[model samples]
Target: MQAQRQLLFGMYMDAMRMDEVIEHCRTALITRRPILLGVLNAAKVVELRRNAALRESLMECDLLLADGQSIVWASKLLGRPLPERVAGIDIFSRLLLLAHKEGRSVAFLGAKPDVLAEMLHVVARRFPGLKIAYSHHGYYEAAEAGQIAAGIRESGADMLFLGMTSPKKEIFLGSYGASLGVPVMHGVGGSFDIMAGLTKRAPIAWQKCGMEWAYRLLQEPRRLWWRYLKTNTSFAQLTAREMFHPDHPFLAGANHRVTSGSPMLPDAQLRSIADD
Candidate 1:
């Protein structure tokens, strides 16, 4: 069964609940068909306006989910209500459990070496039955991406999770995801840190109220304050424009180059942008 997609903020977001997403992933794994999952938050929605490469990479995704409650609220305000915020961390955890229960092997890429090790340790204790096919730190040089992708392909993993930040994760997947032979690929930014206990997710109250960004700002005010301010303000403005001027050209979706069983971008270009 195909989930309904709602076009909001110039992108088509799958209006799927958590259970549906998990079932879709299970089917993808069973069928051995690739499902490149992407997610959008308020910051990403704002970034899409200026980052052509990011926008293109995201458009290539087979499923795009609202990762921020603000995005869900925006959808409701725009008359296209999404089911809920499918936070990347939540989905990552669910997929791990699913893989464990199904006796499927999974691969993990990204995060610092130490953090990756800690996360793997935690995963082993939490899901003892899950098989880890391959694991790699996110600090490899740009030229090493091919070797990394090859390693994942050879490991015979059913699902691959990337804990790197965007648009690096997006670019890497855009360049090499088709060749990796992984049925399910998810870019789960910062989830490694959370799993390793290096960072804490906001309380459920903060998440429900769409104040998770504020909680993050409180966690590291010096580094995140400016970023949140700029992106949040831009997102709010963009949301207002979409709500008030539904026919505006600026709100129109771009000519997206969706994935067609091929790499989204050339290796050279994707690597160059990823290095930037």
Candidate 2:
């Protein structure tokens, strides 16, 4: 399928709805075609600007979806509105249900050892009949990645979920995704913690209002306060630059013609620029 992508924050953001993403994964699983799924949010957007390796890894993804409500809002403000936010945790849950229903096997590769075990237990209870092909904690050294990837490959899993933080998950998948042979690979970040009941997701209202980050900050102020402050401020500045400065290098070579509430370049032009 031809991807409908928008150049948002210097990345090609897939304009895919939740159902479309699920269907794409379904097709990939059936065809044994690999899809390295990447998700972007305010924090990641800020980090990518400074982290060349992480940026390169994310750019290698076959699908890149907006994982933060702020990203969707930014897209609209920048006149390249995405359909909606496809949060990583939501997709991870949906995929688990899909795997359970289809009797497909999945592999988990991240989280503390006990947390991983607890997550597996939760999965078995919550998603009975969901085949677990392999599982491991995220405590291994960089040198052991090849062996771990080899084990995942031999597990015959249809999907692999990494519970590690970025850019560890992104870099690992970028390095070993093809060799792992999994049809669908997703870096789910803290979804495993949520599954294990070690962390709580923000309420639906907070999520809808795009205040999930604030809620998270409230949960762990010391560890995340400064990080969120720095990233959120940086992301807001970046978005503002794109909004007020169309001639900026990030949006270079684009004709800023607005049509139907979107200031997107023609599809042909976007394709040409993406090719370069």
Candidate 3:
């Protein structure tokens, strides 16, 4: 689990492997702290630069799962290969199955105004007895953050899935978790759109081939082309640099890397950065 938390610009190495994720799902069923699955992609790491506080906030989560194939490839190149890519959609469905079996309830907190309502019906029909406590579209103005927090508190939801993008979800979780007492807070980018019948996941073959990003690009060419243009390129370049430059601080002194043998980075350097 610790092999992944390098400081590459506040990017998190995902903690749970596929088997571990399955185990955690089962554990959450019994323990009542619904698991918070964070899907980290290259774009999200880049987006972190805009909000320093949000990076720190995500660093405090119970778990972060690698949702992007690039991340898995990076870990492999770094000589710390992860077990598998745990996509957000896959984890969501896995959790739902666990919830169905355990009779646990869940709440949806982000999506288009009517998307959550539609999702509730779809999910309820698909998984009998799955309870949905409350849901809201994630279009609140800045002033309404507090009100949204209050709404979460009032809902008594066990697992709150913030279907917003990075920093937004992290900000919401870090701000609201203290008062709301929800056990899990999942940051599911675009999952609501998929759940609300607005988009489709790539085929299992495509996902397994690690071409899911390509499929998405084909689907939403105009909206996502620019985003992919920057993030994908930056990630590829940065990852390559890390592969060649072992001395880089981002890879050397990351928080999540498990330091088992010779240290990946000098302990003093790591301690200093961590102190700051």
Task: Name the TM-score of candidate 1.
Answer: 0.89
lDDT of 1 by residue, 32-101 (tens): 9999999888767766665677777888899999998889999999999999999999999999999999
lDDT accuracy of residue 258 in candidate 2 = 31
lDDT of 3 by residue, 1-276 (tens): 333454333345554577677676566656766555566666654444334455566666667667888777777777766667888777777777777786766767776688777877778888998877767788778799888788777887766777776567777776666677666567676677777677777888988888888897798788666666656666566566656654333332245432221112222222111000
Cα displacement (angstroms), candidate 3, residue 126, comes to 1.0
Model 3, position 171, has a per-residue lDDT of: 75
lDDT of 2 at 263: 24
Root-mean-square deviation per candidate: 6.4, 8.5, 8.3
| Candidate 1 global lDDT | 0.82
Ranking, TM-score, top scorer first:
1, 2, 3
Q: After superposition, how far is residue 187 of candidate 1 from its true place, in Å?
A: 0.3
How does each model score on TM-score?
Answer: 0.89, 0.88, 0.81
C-alpha positional error of residue 201 in candidate 3 after TM-score superposition, expressed in Å: 1.1
Judged by whole-model lDDT over C-alpha atoms, candidate 2 comes out at 0.81
Worst 10 residues of 3 by lDDT: 267-276
lDDT for each residue of candidate 2 in 1-276, tens digit (9 for 90 to 100): 775788887788898899999999999999999988999987676656555567788888999999988899999999888898898898999999999999999999999999999999999999877899999999899899999999999999999999988778888998899899899999998889889999888899988888887887789788666666556666677788778664222332333333232222222221111000
